[model samples]
Target: MPGRLKLYHNPQSRAVTAHWMLEEAGADYDLVPVEFREDGTRDPKILAVNPMGKVPTLVLEDGTVVTEVPAILAWVADAYPEKNLAPAPGSPERGSYYRWLFFVGSCFEPALIERMMRQDAEPLPKMMVGWSSYDDVIDTVEGALKGREFLVGDHCTAADVYMGAGLWWGGMFKGPRILESEIIQGYIARLAERPAFQRAMGG
Candidate 1:
């Protein structure tokens, strides 16, 4: 059986994504609010759980630590199969599920960060960079949600929570401005209307 779950979080940070996921999973978890140093460094207590010192670190019931937004979302979904937030193992949709999850983490996230920070690196070959370009990443995500209500299946799942949170934050921060399309806006609206998402936002 799974042990007690605890999340080290900072509401203003990416931990909001995990907070949403935990709600979607319907898993009981203790929230450990972390304070940031005046210099913008993370609290050492958070660093103890995640050397990377990132918010959204999840400590499993058995004392296993899970970091990174993608990993935490995936773990929560899988751990609570009764919630059906993720596709079952060995199912065909599982491929689409994992693909979008990793795409959000590996591709879209880096691209958004680079644009937000206004990186000055010389243009590298599209093959060299994982994201290729921010526009390319945004276009791909837009295309995925063009006519669909959810990324993977008919109903909302972990993919929606993960990707939706990214899009919502991207628009909220106005950094990369990736959520400019009507399709994406509509999708985000749907996500925002969810009870789980509302609860995560403390509404």
Candidate 2:
């Protein structure tokens, strides 16, 4: 039997990604909605559960708390391997799966933030930059996604869970067709069609 799963969520936050992941993993869980207070503060009650006061925090039956979007998705998938949302550790595809997941959090996110803040004009050492540049990161991801349905292969894995969410958010800042590349747009479209994603999106 699986453990009880509790998901703290605020639809407008990163919790949306975990909601899709929970549906994809087919995990038995409950979504506790959090609302911002009228006084311009987050719900103090949730702050007790997550000191960082962030949404999308996962609480396991064993009372363990998991934060961070990628970590939460990775844990939920690993906890329910029967879903096969990820390549098991030690497999060749696992390397690519992990690579894509981390790259979104480490590389793509920073670049998007930098671009949105309009700070890219400042001279900075490319080597010192983590995500390098938005253009470079987009090119790298587009090249990798060209012939593959998913980041790892033809199968939908946990990496797609994160990457797809990233693309959706990127579209908000970069416009509706940020990933209009033939392959990437199609790939994201396919992922969007999944019953799980649609279901999580309140289909």
Estimated TM-score per prediction? 0.93, 0.92
Candidate 2 structure, TM-score to reference = 0.92
TM-score of 1: 0.93
Instruction: Please give the RMSD of candidate 2 to the true structure.
Output: 2.0
Per-residue C-alpha lDDT of model 2 across residues 133-152, encoded as one tens digit per residue: 77888888888888778888
User: Which candidate leads the pack in lDDT?
Assistant: 1
Backbone clashes in each candidate structure, one number apiece? 2, 0
Candidate 2, clashing residue pairs?
none
Deviating ranges (above 4 Å) for candidate 1: 119-124, 176-179
- For all candidates in order, the CA lDDT equals 0.86, 0.84
